[model samples]
Target: MNKKTIITILIALVAMAGQAQKHLPAFQYSKEPAVLSGQIIGNNQQITESVHVRYSLKYTSGMGDALRQTSAAVDADGRFTLSLPTGTTVDCHVAVGECRFICYVVPGQTVTFTLDLNKLETQGLANALTFSGQLSDFNHDLVYATEQGIDPETIYRDIEAKRNMGQLANELPEKSEQGYFHYLDSTYQRVNELIDNDREIGQAYREFAKAVNRYEWGAMMPFCGQSIQYAGIDTDEAYDAFEARLKQRLEVYMKDDPWANPVLCYVMWSMPETFVDSYVSHPVKLPTDYQQCHLASKFLEQMGAQRFLLTEVQKDSVLTFLPELAQDVLDYNERMERELSFVSEQGMSRVCTLPDNADDILATILKPYNGKPVLLDLWETTCGPCRLAFKDMHDKKKDLADRIHFVNIASENSDLATWQRLIPNYIGDHYRLTKQQLQSLHSQLPCNTSGVPIWVLINADGTIHHAFTGWRNVDDMMKEINQVLQ
Candidate 1:
């Protein structure tokens, strides 16, 4: 080829490259904290004043115990800034009153946006309102897609319905394995097309969104099948065929580096026991790169604990599988150990005698701590959320240990042995009541609902200050406690 012809071709190639780069911006990951700052640009005073940014952090697959939350408050002028502790990228939600919308955030970067409460309330549109700074293109595309009727919440609701009702209520014409797989494939293709066709989406976010959609679609089979088994409708032959097909689909999906997205890690970790067992028995060979190896180690660690109690040998076995990533695995485990050391070395168990009369149960339980305010926690050993709340409040409880009396009450529904074994991790005055006694106690209290993890705040003079069900954050709990204390 002549020099003139070669030079012309090189120039044309450079132009093409630049055009492609314009459509797909480069993204770099960092460990530094990411800042999300925004303003409410509407006339809704209630929403602007109450807005908060909250997101769950899942660094590992054992999220039930490992999950942590980060939240930030908005000021009177409708401006708010939240620092997200992330190494890679994370999906977070911006909550205003009862409504919330999703946003993508990365470490060491600032994402600025505005929320129009009027538009959000009337039309339910939470698109950028106004977007700027890093990841503006990505967030705009995400919110745009969601508004156009392609939303993850729709997919999640379908999966949830199948789990609860034993069948798919939307989209699927048939309930068979083939039909379910078809639904997954069709939904995934639609989402994929939406991301691919949008020239506005950056390369990093496009990849992450695709990975998240793929994993969620792939996970539905096992998740739904497990629910069916629990409902006693699933058979060995059907489930085996379903598992085999799912494994095959995953093989193709894994090639795309799906685990690179940390959001997908939450999906993987949420898999049912049956799925985890199947994966352990018939393991798929993952990429041997640093991120892949570290993810594999965390997966095994979580699965081992979920399937059965993990011993030292079992943990060592995880390292053996990823010898090259041994240090990474060790570091993750050490960090997790430090975070989860909620079990107190010094026993905080206080033995309490139960009154014979069913009606006297509440009075007798509160008799010992007469002059001090008491936070009575009604929970059960079998309740997963109850245990999670205990872990979340452990540190906060210690800080307020001297100011107030923290008491725990359980009923016959919780096994005695299990209750005894778990209470050491929960430092408080413990009481196990008979079923009738618990019923009577609930009747006496102003409980909104009959549920576990109920909170009853008693004044120092033994009057019931407040009674409510479900878990509240430490700040909210302290606020209520302080009112009674004053």
Candidate 2:
């Protein structure tokens, strides 16, 4: 063969090879699944040898829909495969453990990693090891960027400390914006530097991260908009100035979707209720009507029908006022119901009866399990710490099953359907109560704050023995329970 012919044939072969390498099949929904595998090294003697690696895997459907969480499990070392439906981007996390990581997976992809618990706690996973798969570099970038972001507590403290300055309440309108923007700008610069310097990170993730940053920063605007200095005074001049300032501040987010800008959207969503008549023309009363005026509707309009509908659904207020605007969203939800299916392997949870209030709780619920000391787990469905506490206490509950009565009381604000669905995952006596009831019960208990999952221990004599909040480890809980028992 001639030299030219050979060269052309070689070029053609390379092109064909490239095509073959890139030709991944279209996602087959549930027909195929993705796998996540990893090994945990440096497991101390205290840590279980074969730990249950459970995670709540949240992902978005390819069709641009709401996020969903699927419960997944794998042995700490048994390839730790995660089989998920196709065309999803997953954020995986152990209930309370620090194995939180994000990855975009398609059907038939196997993403793998090794986590060193010791290094993970101190140096973070970004410094510990490398992640491998198509989305590995993107995932790594996310970790690196997050590791470099400013600590939220620092900013919170700076803003809050000013409250003691006495002048800060008056200076809030001017000072908060400067402080907020300073931190936000610094965060933006740091993340942008990482993105620009890294070639491995994809353009898609870079864009997404930018959106997330904007949304986070946007949420703080509401606090900045409020006039703490002039708490109850009603002035037309102050009102006009506040409205103008808020409108000016919101220019950046005017075009963004409510979901993408959840914080800002939520503040705007609440404006109607909190600042009623503040938006009406020739407002005679409130001074900050502009902040409440037409902003939510404008945001809803910019979010378009689908996003608006989903936002309303999340607020649990759809079909109340925005039915005309939500026809498309309703249709989309219906379509998803038909097209998607989940095959959950969660076993049947032991059913427990729910009592009405603290009165009924003492009379019927607690009275029934009279002999055993009760550990009241006050939790709600959406509380992250609450979920983590429950997950961490799982094994302890199984071991200490006979010693104590585990009573889980969910706040009334929790979705009843979701509460019922999730209760099966937990082992305990379950009950639901309103905020009024929770406070009434708290007054009678040892707890100081209304926050949950508040642990309230009832002595065998039916008197309050102890109450604490936050994720108290298994050992701490055992010590408390045993102390009460003694």
Candidate 3:
């Protein structure tokens, strides 16, 4: 090689090596552990005793395997220290006793902070505490920004209330779109200001949070947009415009950072739901055109989004549409198979039938209140709405404590620990069934759906009077309960 060319190559190699080192600063700490120490105080500003503290440090965005969890127990003086993985941005959840606080972090740098239990108790444990450390200020600001951002529940509740009052304007669809977009714009402005002005935030977390925030904003828009209804926005021309604009915005986010967010994957998987207003009543096939088919195929390949479809119905729809993505379906089945095998190996035998021993499992479960009416709840620990519904009717259940037998049967997939923690909050009898047993029981039900939380009301005569999925229609549910009581 020429001397000049060799010199040029050496210079280029040196520059590349410098850039590579910048990206891998965390690897240096692999040999030397990173420490996160903190102190906890109660409402009286005194050190809390015997507090159990824990936190899960996970990649800001990735598969389940990227999780690194650490925890520590606070002494009588309320001081504790824990080790954490350094380098990448992690979504950190810190717990003190029963109160938990969430914050983001890049762990190599020393972190020291004090949490005020007084503020946590009054404000509620969600994103209320701030942090102080090398990158913690920016992380704290991001958490604050998240708190200030528009709440989806507030928006939905307003819409429902407006609808009920018949005071919704015909232009609400347009207004709702504006409201959501404005929120996104405001959040972006705040984040950008923090990144530009905060010298210590560092480039790695800056880039990660920017991409994540943008994608999440875009992901939330469709739901907000579709919820807008006063005058119909479902007309073909209107919906097509809305859909096109959404796709255009998503394309921008995808171009900037494809792997940094799961929002794109969610949008792709939810494509079928977009047609609910227009084509739901009329039977239609997926990937209805070449353009859609191409988009769906590309997104599936890019996001590996097949794991999002946990239900049989969702899997069936995808398999029917894009035959080429059959491997994703197979992978999910294999995962379920492994889970089943592991459960069995743990001595968790799944009995499918109520044993011929009238002392049979199902029979024994229901035999206590044989003549009285029973309201059966089929749910899982992961089901948020189920928990909400149960809590919402806690008072009502207490009032009816003498009249109805509230029996809750948790799905096999629920962890025993989680079930134990949550079951006590509900006033009822609780039983847990394995996935095999749950499926077998479901076969006897008259409904065709396979989602929870499913509620079934049994008449005083011990016959099933009503059954349904979801916990939204409390009034309808109450009507059935009253009918069964009568």
Best candidate, lDDT-wise? Answer: 1
Q: What's the CA error at residue 367 for candidate 3, in Å?
A: 9.7
Clashes of 3: 0
Report RMSD for candidate 2: 12.3
lDDT of 2 by residue, 1-486 (tens): 999999999999987754532322221223345666665666553133332222321222221122234544435443354555533223444321435544445446776766666686689767764677655655566566555542232333455466445444554334454554555456556655655666554454454555444544554455554424433326888667766665565554443333323223212222323322222322322122222223224333323211222455533443443333334335555543332221113232345554553464444557877877888888887776676566567667766677888888887779888787667557777787777776666666655665767888888777778888887566887899898778
- How displaced is residue 308 in candidate 2, in Å? 21
Q: What would the TM-scores of all predictions be? A: 0.65, 0.46, 0.42
Q: Model 2, poorest ten-residue lDDT window? A: 56-65
Clashing pairs in 1: none
State each model's CA lDDT, in order: 0.65, 0.52, 0.54
- Which residue pairs in candidate 3 have backbone atoms (N, alpha carbon, C) closer than 3 angstroms, thus clashing? none
The residue-level lDDT of candidate 3 at 449 comes to 46
Candidate 3, residue 268: the lDDT equals: 33
* Model 3 residue 377 distance off true place after TM-score fit, in angstroms: 4.8
Report the lDDT tens digits of candidate 3 across residue range 1-486: 999999999999987754542321221212234566777766434445543333432211112222355667777667787767533334465666666455444445666667777776677433446556644554454444445433222333454465456554353434566655665556556656655565544444455445444544554555555444524566889877877766665555445344323323212322333433332223333222222334334433222211222456645665776454445434644664464344335433222224434323444556677889999888887776676566456556767877998888887698887776555445677778766667666766667547888887877766778888888645767888899888
In TM-score terms, candidate 2 sits at 0.46
lDDT for model 3 comes to: 0.54
RMSD in order of candidates: 6.8, 12.3, 14.4
**Number of backbone collisions per candidate:** 0, 1, 0
Which of the numbered candidates is closest to the native, going by highest TM-score?
1
